[model samples]
Target: MAADPTHRAIEAVFRIERARLIATLARMTRDVDRAEELAQEALLSALTEWPKSGVPDRPGAWLTAAAKRRLIDGARHQSMLERKHAEIARERDAETDMSAEAIEAARDDPLGDELLGLIFAACHPVVSPEARAALTLRLVGGLTVEEIARAFLSSEAAIAARITRAKKAIAKAGVAFEVPRGAELRARLGSVLEVVYLIFNEGYAATAGPSLVRPPLCAEAQRLARILAGLMPEQPEVVGLLALVEIQASRLAARADVDGRFVPLTEQNRARWDQLLIRRGLNALDRAEALGGTDGAYVLQAALAACHARARSAESTDWARISALYDRLAEVVPSPVVELNRAVAHSMAFGPEAGLRLVDDIANAALLRNYAPLPAARGDFLFRAGRTGEARAEFEAAAALAANERERDFLLARAAACAP
Candidate 1:
């Protein structure tokens, strides 16, 4: 049976409000797991009540209030500490008694600090770095375990266990659930940025879905980047990350066709790209350079993206400059993935032979063994070099490894095109 419209609306509201609600509840409960449960309880309450009486004018506030009341009740029943119970009761009563207009205004509040704190907490050093990304996506990006699993190419069970362990580790370590300051902020910022970038990359090209793009996920990551930039205006890397996502997001419109077919960056219509985002990204990039973040990993990546943004057409792209930026990026943050990308840039700047040689050098790297993009990129170079048989084989291998349906289809089509 089709889901009721009311229920669908409630689901949509919950998905949008979930991260904020959990952040607020985490503040109140001082326990991430409890906060999540409380948020779910609020969602269940909304599903039950919203249909009975039309949805509230401010559903987010209504959900927050519901969660707060549940918190108060749970505290009253479980905590023998009168001080805790009284504190919970007072907070609940204060918010629940607010005038509708005041409640609306409160809801309109930026969620700047609260959400940022939750993000930092989720990415705390106490959690394993991989787990940190998964947890941050869950708590701050409002992604589900299944979605996160797909993003990471892991099983749902593994992702769930990783998140559970991360929460437990944070609780046991008594990690502060507040944004760090001074040197501590700088120390913690890298992990936080890593998580945000992971979220954006997943949305930019989803790992396992019918659709090539997940707009909501991309928007959430972009919003998080902007929030981080605001909270740490002096941090050049943070600003660079904001710039990177802005420039990359500008291409979302042209990344796919009206029929939802994948469009390679070189083939995407430049006019469809959002000029406003490109301008914002360039302005932010200038700010990063002014702040002396010219060599930062994100800044280098942003510069690479800027190369494309500045190009009037694919033929006009400064591939040589992009290759140089990727060289600098690899120096700042060396990895097989960076090498693979660098190869592509070298090919564009030089020739298919140059790129193919680079790809062959890393073909044996364990990290790229099952990574579809490795073979897929190599296939492109080989095809351009007129090695159609080898290119077809590589494309088939990439298609076999692809998890996203759309990406797999694109790879298979490339394989077919290479047939004699």
Candidate 2:
């Protein structure tokens, strides 16, 4: 069935401006749930009116204003203080004729502290790390429960519950909606970085989408990381994160062809990579290292990415160095995902057999039961070893498990190539 054009337009606007809307609302309401509710109500308004009114030229601002008015109306119904109501009313009235240019200009302003404050609040240590990731994407990344669940390979119900508890936990702990300081700042920063990286990764390889990558989301996360680096110039992790995102984003241009076909790393036209972004990433990596973050998780990952960025082509890649970096990265942040990456690295550096041993170990783990990458990696190793039949089966399994349509198609093509 065809999706409603108006619905798609509304969803697109929400995706692009969600962070701004939530940040602005959170700043005004200081209550996570209320801010989300206000935004949801505005979204409802868009759904009902946009089809008939013809989508607004400044839809984001239109939605923002609608949400703000709703906030003010709620305050009025509750008989809130006149000073508060008057202040909000004056602010809303000033933008009676909102223009798209005005909306873009206002949102373009340097990562104002309000968005950063909302991020800090989302990363409060009171909630679990899983909850932190979910809440950060929900409140800051503006991802829906279903989107978040697909990204995490969890059920939508679980993700929704986690978001609910996270908001309540933040309120219960009385966590302030401002960036922290000194020890508190250092403690919470890691979680925030983790969440931003997760958002970026999802954009880099969308979990469930027609395209393998979502450039807007990637640009959004990159913008946030760039903003964060500016906010905390001396923080090694922040600099490292900026480096990692910039480096990965450099390849975005080369990931697909003019015909929208997926291009493997070995087949990509290296000349298409963004040199400016690569240089910016390398500079940030240098700064991270200078700040004594050689052992940091993000720094390690950025260094690994640098190895690829430094190579002019796939044949010139320093797989040995990348393998070593992955080994250290595994220790810094032990997870099934890291292990899988290391196995791939080992295969490239050593031999397919050496990598396959590690791959099989990860394949049997219950955690990766539905993970597409596991079978995909195993398929590559089998193909390298000349086991055509086995490789075809693995590739077919990977294609089935893959959530992104592009990725699934790519895998299926590989499976077809293995035929007799």
Candidate 3:
């Protein structure tokens, strides 16, 4: 069955306005869960009434008003509870004197600092990193629990439990719904940025999905990163993250084939890449560097991307410089993923044999046991070195382990090409 046009329009508007809607409601109600519920209630009202009444001049404002009414109704019910009836009644009386028009005015404040405040609050230190990320994506990115679960390669039940526990933790710890200040702001903002980038990276590469890219998630993360960059233009890391995502996303068009099969960087069509986005990324990188942030992870990653952007062809790429940048990035971040990427740079800088050696070492390391890319990289190197039979086996193994259908097909095709 086809979806109603009105419903689709409401969904689109809600996706764009969801963060602000929830933020304003959370500020008023002081309960994240209730704010979400009220927002959903407003959405239901829109679906019911908008068709006959037609879309409003300000759909967001209309939704905000409906959600506020729902909140007021819920508060009235709370006033009847025996445990804190007196306090609830007093608060209700105070709220009665405040007109909905005034409340709507408050919600419509163009500054939207509340949205940023909500981001920091959702990513507060009281919650675990995983929980913080889950909640932020749910509340800010407007992603469903199932979508996040798919991104994390986990079950929907597990993601649901994690979000529940996160909310409980926030309430138990009495986390405030305001933004942090000074040094605390800096620290907490890093977690927020990490969550945003994690979502973008998942969408960009889709570690476990049928498609090579989830363009919606990438676009959403880029939007959030751009918002953050605008909100805090002085922050170097904010600029760095924006630069990194912009550059990476510029290559999305050429990252896959017409049939949705994966295309490695060396084989991608450079003309299909978005040069406008590349220029924006370079400008953002310049801003970060001008602010004296040189060695940060995102900044370094952007620098690596710039190397590719500058090259007219695969052979023209500055492999040595990329290897050096990877060296710096590995030192700063020091993760298995960074090391894996550094190996690729080394391979490009030297020879397939040099890359094979690095891949071999990583293969034996217990950490990459379930990582499909290790074998995939090895297969590519072997294929380039004229070891077709060995490459075929490796490619088949990679295809078997890969979760994404597009990547699996690419590997399978490569393996078939080596057939006798």
lDDT tens digits, residues 296-397, model 1?
Answer: 999999999999999999999999999999988888998999999999999999999989988888899999989999999999999999999999999999
- CA lDDT, every prediction? 0.87, 0.84, 0.83
TM-score of 3: 0.82
* lDDT value for model 1: 0.87
| TM-scores of all predicted structures | 0.77, 0.70, 0.82
User: For residues 1-420, could you state the per-residue lDDT of candidate 3 as single tens digits?
Assistant: 129776898788777878988987787667899889999998889888888998777777788878877766665686666535346446656766345455567566655678887887788778887788788889988889998887677899999999999889887877777778898888887888887787788889988767889887788789889988888788888899999999999999899989888899988899988999999999999999998879988889889998998788987999999999998998999877778888888888988898888777667777777677878788888888889999899899988999888988888988999865
Tens digits of per-residue lDDT for model 2, 1-420: 129876887788877767768877876777888888888898888888888888888777888877876886776665555676666666666767555566557656464666788889998878887798789877776667887787666799999999999999998888778787899888889878877787788778777766677776677679779878987888999999999999999999899877666788778898999999999999999999999998899999999989989999899999999999999999999888899999999999999998899887777777888899999999999999999899999999999998788888899999999965
The CA-based lDDT of model 3 is what? Answer: 0.83
Between prediction 1 and prediction 2, the one with superior lDDT is: 1
Top-down lDDT ranking: 1, 2, 3
Ranking by TM-score: 3, 1, 2
Could you tell me which 10 consecutive residues in candidate 2 have the lowest summed lDDT?
Answer: 103-112
Candidate number of the best lDDT = 1
TM-score of 2: 0.70
